[model samples]
Target: MTTGRHAGSRAPGSCAQSAPLVLALLLAGCAVGPDYHTPPLSGTEAPQGWHATLPHHGSRMALAHWWEQFHDPVLTQLVEQADATSPTIAQAVGRVREARASVSTNRAALLPQLKGSGSATRQGGFGGSQFAGGAGGLSAGALNPTLGLGTITTLGAQADASWEIDLFGGKRRSLEGADARLTASEADWHDARVSLAAEVANTYLQQRECEALVDIGAATLSSRQETLQLTERKFRAGFVAPADFAQAQATVGDAVNALEGQRAQCAQGIDKLVALTGLDHDALNGLLSKASAQIPAPPDPGVPDVPAQVLSQRPDVSSAERAVAGASADALASYRSKVRQAVQEVEDALVRLDASERRVDAATMADAQYAKVLEASNARYRLGAGSLLQLEDVRRTALQASQSLAAVKLERAQAWVALYKAVGGGWRDDAPNPHPDHKTTAPTAQGRTHTGSAS
Candidate 1:
C-alpha cells in the first residue's frame, strides 16, 4: 500500500537531519522473498484461439453457477443441497477461514506488540532482633520483639511495547505469502464446489442413463417374449423345426438376462447417488420416480478457443498458478507442471468427447439399418419367403444395435459432462474468476437452452 511519494518524501527544516537515516531504513525494508507474479502460459498452448475445436457459437459462455444451465429443477436442488451438505466443501470452507486467520496473524506482526504484567510480594523480618543487636539487647527485648517482626507487602504493575522493524522485509514477505495463500484457499473452495457440482451431475446423469437402458431392455424383452410365443405355436403345430422355437426361447432368455443386468446397473447408479447426496434410498427413489429416464442436458458452456481463457475458469489451475508464483524454483516447476497436467486433462476430455460423438453417429446409423433389415426379415417370413432363423437373426441384430446405440448415447452424455468439467463448468467472466490474469468477454444474460447442445 505504500506509495513512492510517501516512501521518499522528506520532512522540512530540523527534521531533514534524520531524513537520510529514515529513508535508508525504509528503502532497506523490501519484501525478502520472490514477489508473486502471474505465471505466463506458453503462447502455443494458449494462443489467440484455443487449439481445440469450438463446439458451436453463441454469446460467450457463463461459467459461474453453470449447474443452473441444466434447466432441471431437481438438478439445481441437488447441487445446492450437495454444496450445503458436502463435508468436502465444508472442509474447503474451513481451510479458507483458516487461511484468512493466518493472513490476519501475519498482518498483525507489522504493528507494535503490547503486553501487560503485574507482580506482588510479601516479606517478613524480625526487626526487633536486629534492633537489639545494634542497641542494648535488654532494651530491645523489653520493647516488643514481636512488634518488630512485621510483614511487608508490595505490589507492582507495568506495561511493555516492542516492535521489530521489518528491516529485511521478511515480515512483509510473510504477509505477502499469507495473502497469496489466502487467495489460493479461496480458489480451492471454488474448485471444490465446482468439482462437487460436476460429480453430482455425472452421478445423476448415470442414474438417468441406467433407467433409460433398463426401459430399453424391458421393451426388448416384451417383444422377444411375444416372438417366442408365436414360435411356440408353430412348434406345437409341427409346422416349424424345434430349433426355431428353441432359438426364440433362447432369445427371450437373453433378453431376460440383459434386463436383469440393466436393473442391477440402475440399482448401482442409485446407490452411488445415495452415497453422494447422503439421501436415504426411499427418498431418492421417490425423487427419481417422478423424473423421466431422459438425461439432464445442461447448456453448453461455449468454451473459448483460447486455452488461457478456458484455463482461467478452472479454480484448480488458478490455485496452482498462484502457488507457482509463491514457490521456489523447484516448487515453481512442480506447480507449473500441475498446470500443464490440468491443460492436458482438458485436451483428453475433448478427445474423448470427439470420439463419443463419432460412436453415437455410428451407432445411430447401425441401429437404423438393423431395424430396416429386421423389418424386412419379418415381412419375408410372414410371406413364407424367408426362414424363421433369418427372422430371429435379424431381430437379435436389431435389438443389439438398439442397445448399442443407447449405450453410445449414454457415453456421449458422459463425455459432455466430462468436457464441461474439464473446461471449468460455470466459472465465468462476471464472477470472481479464479485466474488472476483473466479478463475475458462477459457471458450472455439470456437463459440457457434446456436441450443440451451436446445432445
Candidate 2:
C-alpha cells in the first residue's frame, strides 16, 4: 500500500509538470474583454417622421472644400494658403499623426514585445590544467571554485518575447481606451477645420458689415453737413432758433466722431485679416479690394432635424465626451483625481448650452431695440419735424441694427453648430442616413447658380 501511494504521488507530480505547457496551448485563441466593438454611432433613424437635419435635397459638398460652398475661388486659394501656413492647424495635424502612431504602438505592444540582444567579451584567467600532479592547475580556482576554470568569449543573438495575454482584460481595455482617444483626435481635427471655416466666414461677413457701416456713416455725415448749412441759414434769416443751430452742430460733431470710430473698426478688421494671412495687409487689400466680395447666402435647404447624435457628430460634443473619458481614465490612472471633477465636466458641457441660448436672447433684444429707434427716427423725419440730420442718424442706426441682428443670427447659428460639435453630434462617413448637407448638388453662386470663385 505504501509503494502504491508513492507511485500515485509520482504520477501526479509528472502530470502537474506538464500542466503549464498544456494550459499555454489551450489559451492561445483567447483575448480579453468582450472584443472591442466600436461604440454604436447615433443618427441612423429619421426624426419626427421627416428626414432629420436635412429637408433640403442637396448633395454632399466636400467640407474639405468648404470655402467652395461660398463659390469663391479667392476664398478657396486663401484658405489653402492659411492651412499650409497656419502654425495652429499644422500643430493640430501633427498631434493627430502623433496620436495615430501612439495607438499603433499600443496595439503593437499588445501582440508580443520581442527583443534581440548580443554581447562579446575577451578575458584571460588562470587555467586549471591537468599538467601538475594530475590536477588541472588553475591557481584562481585551486583555493576555491570562486574563479571560472577558463576565460570564454561568447557572441550570441536571441529573440525573446513574453505577453501577459491580458487574461484579466486590463490591457485589452487599455487598447479600447487608446482607440477611443484616436477617434477623439479625429474629432479634434474636424473641430479645427470647422472652426477655421467659421472664422473665415465671420471675417468676411464682418468686413462686409463694416463696409455697410462706413457707407451709412458717410451718408450720415453728408446729411449732418446739410443740416448745419440749413440751420446757419435759418439763424441768418432770423427764422430759426439758436437751440436748433446748437443741436445741429452737436449732431454733426457726433456723426464725425462715429465715422472716425467706424473707420478704425474697418481698419481693425483689415488687421485681423492680415494676421490670418502670412501676407501683408496692404498686399491682401490689393488682392481683396475693400470693395465687398458678394457673399452667397447660406442655403436654407430646410431646418436640419438635429440628430439624436447630440454627441457623436459635433466637435464640441466629441471633445466634451473625450474630456469625460479622459477624466475617467485619469481617475483610473490615479485614485487622486476625485469623481467630482468628471461630474463637473459633464455639468460644464450642459452649462455651455445655456450660455449659448442666453447669447441668442441678448442679441435678439439688442437688435429689437435698435430697430425701434431706427423706425421712430425715420418716421419723425418723414413728418418734417425732424431734420435731415435726424433722418441720416435713423438710417445709420437702422443699418447698424439690421447688421447687429444678422451678426446675432450668425452667432446663434455658430453656437448651435458648436454645441452640436461639442456634443459629439455628426454623421460618420459610414452612417446610413447621412445629413442632407452630406448629399451632393451643383454649387450655386450669388443666387444665379454660377460656379465662380470669390475675388
Candidate 3:
C-alpha cells in the first residue's frame, strides 16, 4: 500500500511541475489593448499645384538649403550660425534623446527582470538557567561549568527573477506608444531646424531692406540739399520770393529728419541680426559690409507641387501626422486640427506673393510716368513757361513714386520668403510621408499664380 501511495504522489508532483508551462501557453494567446493603425492624413486632397501657379510650372524648386537660392553669402552664413548656436535647436535635440531613452526604458519591461541580494549577521544570547546551578535554578555563584554565550555568524546570498508574461499585451501597447513618440520627437527636431533657418533668413532679409531704405533716404537728402542751395541763391539775388526759400529749407530739414530715422532703423536691424546669429557686433558688421548694398534677388524657387509634397516636406505636418497615428482619441483630434492649419498657411503665403507682385508692377509703372512728368516740368521751367513751384512739385512726385517702388520691391521679396517658409523651406518632394498608406492628390485648376522670387 505504501509503495502504491508513493507512486501516486510522484504523478501528482510531475503534473504540478508542468502547470507553469501550460499557463505560459495560455497567456501567449492573450494580448490586451487596442491595436494601432495608421491614421489617414487630413487636408491632403488638394491638387498638385498651388491655387496660384508659378511661371515655371514644369521645373521643381529645391528648398533644401533654400537660403542658397537667394545667392547671398551673408544669408547663408547667418542660417548656418543660427543652426549651430540656437538654443531652440539644442532643446529639440535634447528632447529626441530623452524620447529615445524612454523607449529603451520601456523596452526593458518586455524581458524578465533579475535581482541579486546578499547579507551577513552576528548575534549572541545567554540562557539564565545556564549561568545558574541545577537545584531549582540555584544561585549564580554556583554556576554550571557549561555556562557560556557565543556569537553566531551567518552569510547568505540569493538571486530572484520574475516576468509579467504580458498576458494582456499592456507592455506591447506601451512599447508601441513609445516608438510612436520617438518618431514624433525626431520629426519635431527637424521641424525646429526648419523654423530656425527660416527665422535667420527673414532677419537677414529685413536687414538688407533696412539698408536699402537708408540708401534711399541719403540720396533724397542730398537732392533736397542741392535744391535748397539753388533756392537760397535765387532768394539772395531777389529772383525768388522768401516764401519759396523757406519752403526749400523746410524740405531739406524734412529729408534730414527722414534720413536720421532710416539710419536708426538700419541700426535696429543690425542689432536683431546680431542677436539671432549669436555673433559679436563687430563680426556681424564685417559680414554685412561684404554683402551688396542692394537687396539680392530671391532665388527662382520652382512651382510647388501636390499637397502631398507639402506634407512630406513640412516637418510640422509630419510630426502632427505621427501624433495622430499613436495618440489617444482626444490627442489625435488635436493633431488633425493642425493638419488643416498647415494647408491654410501655404495657401495664404501664395496669395500674398501674388498680390505683392501686382503692387510692384503698379509702382514701377507709376514711377516711370512720374519721371516723364518731372522731365517735362524741368523743360518748361527752363523756358520760363512753368513756375519754380511747379517744377519742384513734379520732382517731389517722382521721388515719392521711386520710394514707393523700393518699398514694394521689399514687400515682394518678403512675400517670397513667406512662400518659402510656408512650403517647408525646401522640403524634398520625395521625402517619406508619415502616412505612407494613403495616396496624395493634387490641385486641378490654376488661378493668379504666385510667380517669381523676391528681390
Whole-model lDDT values for every prediction? 0.68, 0.52, 0.68
User: In each prediction, how many residue pairs overlap at the backbone (N, C-alpha, C within less than 3 A)?
Assistant: 7, 36, 11
lDDT string for model 1 (193-306, tens) is 778888998888878878877887888788778777777887898978998888888988998998999899889988887777888899888888877687764455465666
lDDT of 2 by residue, 1-455 (tens): 99999999899899999998788667754644344322232223212222222223323223234345556565655655665567676666666566656556766766977777765544455656432221322222232257645554444456777765655555655655665555455555555655665565567556656766677678767866876787788678886678777877888898899889988998898788777757687777775663463433333212223333222334544444444443364433232122223223323433443454466577668767876886687566545577655666665666566556555555444443333333332233432111122111111110101111110
Pairs of residues clashing in candidate 1: 49-305, 50-305, 50-306, 63-426, 63-427, 64-426, 64-427
Residue 7 miss distance in model 2 (angstroms): 13
Worst 10 residues of 3 by lDDT: 446-455
Global lDDT for candidate 2? 0.52
Descending-TM-score candidate ranking: 1, 3, 2
Model 2: worst 10 consecutive residues (lDDT sum): 446-455
Q: Which stretches of candidate 2 lie over 4 Å from their true place?
A: 1-18, 25-32, 36-66, 73-78, 111-170, 293-296, 301-306, 309-311, 316-455
Worst 10 residues of 1 by lDDT: 446-455
Candidate 3 residue runs with Cα over 4 Å from true position: 1-30, 42-49, 120-155, 372-385, 426-455
All candidates: CA RMSD in angstroms? Answer: 10.1, 12.0, 10.1
